[model samples]
Target: MSEVPGPSKRFSTDNSSFSGAKKPRKTVLDSCTSDENDCSSEEAVYSQCNDGRMDGPFGEIPDHLLINTIETPSVSLLRSSAITPTVSEQSFILPSHIGVAGYSSISALPSFDDNNRQVAQNIDDQPSHEGATATWASTGSMKTLDFTKAQELLVPVPSDPLEAFLLFLNNDILDLIVRETNLNAERVLQQPGVTDKYRITNWKELTREECMTFLGLLLHTGTIRLNRLNDYWKTHWLFNIPSFRQYMSRNRFMLILRCLHFSSDPRDEDRLTEIRPIVDNFNTVMNNIYSPGKQLTLDESMVLWRGRLLFRQYIKNKRHKYGVKFYVLAEPEGIVLKFQIYGGAHEETSGQGHTQKIVLKLLEDNLDSGHSVYMDNFYNSYDLAVKLLDRQTYCTGTLRKNREGNPVDLSTVTLKKGEYKSVFLNNVHIGKWRDKRYVLYISTEHDNEMMEVTNKRGQVLLKPSAIVHYDNFMSGVDLQDQMLSYYPCERKTMRWYKKLFIHVLQMSVANAYYLYNKFSTKQRLNLYDFRLSILEKLLPKKTDQLKVLKVEHKLTKIENVKLREKKERRGIRTIKEIVRKECKGCKQIKKRVATLYECKGCDGSPGFCTQCFCNFHS
Candidate 1:
């Protein structure tokens, strides 16, 4: 068996180059300094024996020449083996003892031909250790290798830093600048000095108060420019600029207008105050606009006002002492068709009558035909109703009771109440004290209209069997309750005045809420809830002073710091104690001691001197 050269016996570069022709010289002796190991020398001698043989005379050469020539072929074999797969020749046989050893057996194991051949062919295929060994054993001479453990080292490709920085600037810096500047332009146009023509320019141009006022108006009008506001904030330079905080103030006049247009409740005081002056001016406006062929409901609203002298002098009726009354005429929807405010001293009878006459005269002078008038029973007398009828306008109201001196038709009286039964008269006279004959008509036929009128004792008095009858039109308690509930007031004393006011204010609030609901398309909120929500958002705080705080450094130095300190020190106190002796001159009074001073005896005589008193007295 031939021995293979170990790693220690490897040739050096300088010696291998100097070896002669025909056969290479062994350079191992020069490559390694001799160590005190016999196994290494033995191994080298064995390696020299297996080195390639030369033919004839060359083969018979001296040991030194043989060694040199033999080393070349062995080195060449090892070099080729490292780069490519090893091939075994028949002469290179393994020794029996060495082949039996565990180390030799492992080295002699079957090489991986199938699995590792695929791995070697494809650069991406990674082979396992067992696979590589099996592959080598199967293909050629067995050689132990761990190609699976090998790692492919990589080098990162370089990038241009300047180009990367420019990209970042384009996306993060330049783009941001463009957005901010555009918003700033918008803000500038909102400024006070900016013309309405240029109002779209920029956000920074507007003052904070101006911006907020515009926002408030838009909100009140239910015109939210959400997208526009967002765009301005995104781009405007002064988007986050601070300003002095102020509480939002409500426009009372606008609120009043809202009420007048929408509220069904007539008793809101605030709405009443707003409507009062407008009511006084109503008649004047109507006179200007009157060409009336239009239908109008003429009615009066009682208003309450406070004044000491007026109340005392004009309130001969005890009820009038608290408040004055006003008359208002309007459409059925309470539009203030016309109105008048009478003085407190005005009489309900003559004063109201005179006012009606004046109103009628004004209508006659300015208005054309086809107009109809509506009034309550109080305004409906035989004389006035007939007079209005003569003016080519129809009048409708309850008639006064005790309408007498008219001839009766017994047969027609049998007809049921609320049942239409009309009679045409050849000549009808509506005299001041006499009943007039006319056609009677009823609109609804309900059974309740046929009820008997009776006294509290269950005795039937007058059964309502006639189609037309004269009876007192009692003011309905249910109507009063409906009126009061709809137009809530503090008390019945202010019922009329309060109802009028409340109706107006509620109308306005309702209108505003309606507008908001219409725009929002949100069904969750009702009119009342919507108004409250808006009120909360708009008027977050009640007072400006309460909301103000000294947050700025300069402002803190001037005001808040000292005030805070003083408030902290107000409750502390200090005390001091002094030691003193008790007086000895005052006490030594005996038992009862009834006559200690004797002032009574001393009062009558100058001789009984009172100059000295007991110590007890002192």
Candidate 2:
């Protein structure tokens, strides 16, 4: 797998704005003793207040929700006081409505103390809410996790890295880019102030080969970087990529980059119309190249573009906080299977929330194929997980403790650093384990069991089976982002669409590298080597020199033909069978030659062999 940042240091969940100052996450959370207030209806060690009152320890509750379920002791009560609570900006509201068969009014509720277990979250994470417990009502029956579909590569991958890369950005896409680039040039020339012919005279229509070479040069800059763009073509020994000049001149490269276009007839009202071709083509090839394995991850990738435009987002949880947000469905090992560009607030449809709609939309093709998806709190919900389960898909992810549809025992309960609470309902196993902080996990794939995971410091930590699986598969997109950062192809551009194209180009190259490593039986090259090889193929030095030599030879032959023709027009030159001197070129090698042609325009008009006749001409 590609290198990615450890979860311990990653940014927060995808979306959250701090209402107050953000505090540093503690490396080692303060440990706590076992809870003394351990009695609950579900029989876990959930802590209570200093006084005796049945209350929700994890989140705020509404009186109506509590008053309706007065007879239910486990309605919103903590299952254990020893379980640390998950920090959440969202407040958990108890769901309303329950049968009041045992009792009627709120006065019959049990009394508790004021001594409450330490809420693992700061007040900033979870807003304060207090009331009675709500009933842990059932939602639906748990269906069996029965998935038996097999995924195979529809097309064969070639051994060549360039070929593999082309699988994603094939010739059709390149041709499209070429056509649009030329179209863009025509469109620009048709505009005012273009007849000056300063940059226009040098502008020629783009070609597929040159277009790919432009991408190659873009990738090359990442490898041999300089402080400035013009440095690559400098004549000085200190700042010259000599081979770069062999493929394209600096002026030509910049001109192509300026005129680069992706689509025709773009719609201004449509946010993605300008770059729709690239996005659509890349997605199609991504799906056609290889079908993903059983385990997939759903997440967001932030392409850094701090420009002014609509739908530009600030995800505090992402390292690149301000940029275009992409909802990506990728494999566990950093293969982007599908992606959706966030257009604006309207990207999220009405009825369903933004997170649910995006997740479902990105996973449309892979749904019900027995793929197990892992996600963070940004997308994972009890309702979504149950919904995926109903579709024969499995999902496991860390949830906000207060997310709606959470089991009351798992959602409202507070536990110490080592305790946990788990309940299975509708095949969705919602488990809250206290390990430094509350880890609320909702899963349709894993059971309510424990698993061991090694931490960054090589220490063993016991986590739920779902949490372990989440840790294992949750970083597919992050892996892609991290690998991309090492040698990025992005440069500062005024056009936001240009930035998007460069970002997608980088993703395609990364995808190509993954396929190369996956299929090549030879000793696999690292990303740098793989990228360098692709660069060499796209802009080769060997053929450039040969082309130079061939052009020189052809130019000389044509120049002589023109000179001979000019002399004939003047009637100043004539070919005669004279006592021919041996050819100068052949005589040098001591080979005798009797030429039928004589040199022209020289004072002597010296007799020479056919090959040496042009050498003696004035």
lDDT of 2 by residue, 1-618 (tens): 112233322322433422233322211111222263323222222222222333332233332322212133332332212122343323332234432222221222333334422222222232112211223333433456555766556788567878887787787988898999998888887877766756855788788878888988888888886767788888554674667787789999888988888888757667788888889998898877787789999888898888787889899989999999888888888988888888885433424466777878788888878888998988876657767776789888888765545544555678988677777654667777898787887787777667777888999977778777788789999999999899876777638888888888888888888877876677788988888788877877665465543432110111122223236555867453334454545676688875555444332344455555544331
Candidate 2: residue 20 lDDT (0-100): 39
Identify the candidate with maximal lDDT.
2
Estimate TM-scores for all models: 0.29, 0.67
Model 2's C-alpha root-mean-square deviation from the true structure amounts to 16.3
> Model 2 residue 429 lDDT?
71
Residue 202 displacement (Å), model 2 = 3.1
Candidates' C-alpha lDDT: 0.32, 0.66
Cα miss at 177, model 2 (Å)? Answer: 0.5
Q: Which candidate has the highest TM-score of all? A: 2
lDDT of 1 by residue, 82-173 (tens): 11123332223444453212221121112224333211122112121121222121012111212121111121211322221122122332
Clashes per candidate, residues 3 or more apart or on different chains: 51, 33
